[model samples]
Target: MKPPTVFMGEMTNREVEAFLVDHQTVIVPTGSTEQHGPHGPLLTDVFVPQEVARRVAPRVGALVAPSINYGLSYPHVGFTGVVNLRIPTFMAVVEDVAASLATAGFTRIVFLNGHYDNTYAIAYACANAADRLPAGVRAFPINYWDGMTADEAGEFFGPTTGLHANRGETSAVMAINPDLVDLDHANAELPPFPAVTNAPAVHTAFFFSTPGSVHRASQSGTWGDAREASVAYGERYLSVVADATVRMLDDVERTFGAMPAR
Candidate 1:
């Protein structure tokens, strides 16, 4: 059987109304427009999450809204292609998008995030919009990497991986669009991991507060070794991310079911 049109932008108004009759869930991809080292494209943050949404939407009987391409990228400001949105602006965009979907009758909305800096903004937007959302409409903002399990993480990132435009992200993008990856320019920049890598409070504060720190840490804007990245590794990363997203959708369905017929 042919698959339903999962992209919201592709459907006619009537088709959308009909599709929503059966599927009350929607996925939104949120990403940043910024530098991702030399090998990764400036669009990496947008591409990875959007592609994950596209791949997972069909399995969960959901529609994928158009991507929120610009995000909070202050840390990467020194880079040539980096573009950063103010926190309020980024959060407002996400809130309005999710609220619109909720008003349109989607009871479950998921924001699949790509950029490291965009996480809090997306979550804040969803959380703040909750009270205004129609009854039973729930919004969740989650990172695409959250889908990777410990074992999967070992396979994808592990000891060799660095943060930012390192192995994992480069590989994920390569899987999505090999043409976008320029491995010849791939480089590694491993900064000293903070002494306590497991302190949530400390890490959270550091991640949120330090934007210029990227400049101080690595000249290449890279965190890990991308030389280890490969098409096969990228495919594996994507499969895990998509599978994880589908599982999340399943949980949403199991907990919320579909909205009562209008």
Candidate 2:
């Protein structure tokens, strides 16, 4: 017999409506198509979050929606194959996507994000789409890496992880598929401007950038040590993200299940 999958795209519409009989939660994977230095795939942002959403959905009795694979990646526009949407366009897409699912009766909507720029877009989309939805529905806009500790990043990435196309992301992609990366081409190149790397996990010590600043600062589009990436580190990242998502799923149900259905 074929085993069940959490991805709703693979299921028939009947199967999806059937899922609502037992589950009201759905995870929407958000990402981008942009440069990841020389080695990492353009879709690394999407693939990483997709891995966690796929791994955790069945365990949480949720379904994974089709990926929102393009985002507002203007900085990477200088690079080939970078497909970025305007900020407003991305938000509209997200709003419609969320609204469609809510219309289908899913109450707990999760936007699992991989790209940093999409942060505000997802939040704003949720707000715009919420008022029109049926009562009791809630949308969660999340950056999956927010769950990672500075210590965890230090342990796996040897003190350097996020920023862009670096060890942590490259390693995670390598674990997903070695063929997706070519380590020989990997290299490190931080932004030319001053940037602090030692803030706490959830806190920021510096402001991000001016418009087009990232493009001016990074020629290669890598902002961390990509050479340090490895398959081992990627495996750990997958496990960590999946574990964190599972725990959050529990919190969503416990905290909101008691509220009257909207």
Query: Would you give me the overall lDDT of model 1?
Result: 0.82
What would the TM-score be for candidate 1 when compared with the true structure? 0.89
Residue 89 miss distance in model 1 (angstroms): 0.8
How many pairs of residues collide in each model?
1, 2
**Tens digits of lDDT, candidate 2, 1-262:** 6567789889989889988998999999999998898898999889999988998888888899999999978766668789978888999999999889999989989999999878977998899988878887888788886666666646544324447888878888999998999899999886544444654432222223334445666788888888978999889878987887777667666777777756
Candidate 1 weakest ten by summed lDDT: 153-162
Across 1-262, the per-residue lDDT of candidate 1 in tens digits comes to 5355788888777888998888898889889888888888998989988989989887878888999889988777788987888999888888899889988889889998888688877788888998889887889887877756788766655535666788878988888878999999998887665677575676566657888667666788888899877878888778888998777666666756655756
Q: How many backbone clashes does candidate 1 have?
A: 1
What is the clash count of model 2?
A: 2
- The Cα RMSD of model 1 versus the native structure comes to 3.5
Candidate 1 lDDT at 172 equals 84
Model 2, runs deviating above 4 Å: 153-162, 195-211, 251-262
Off by over 4 Å in 1: 1-4, 158-160, 194-201, 252-262
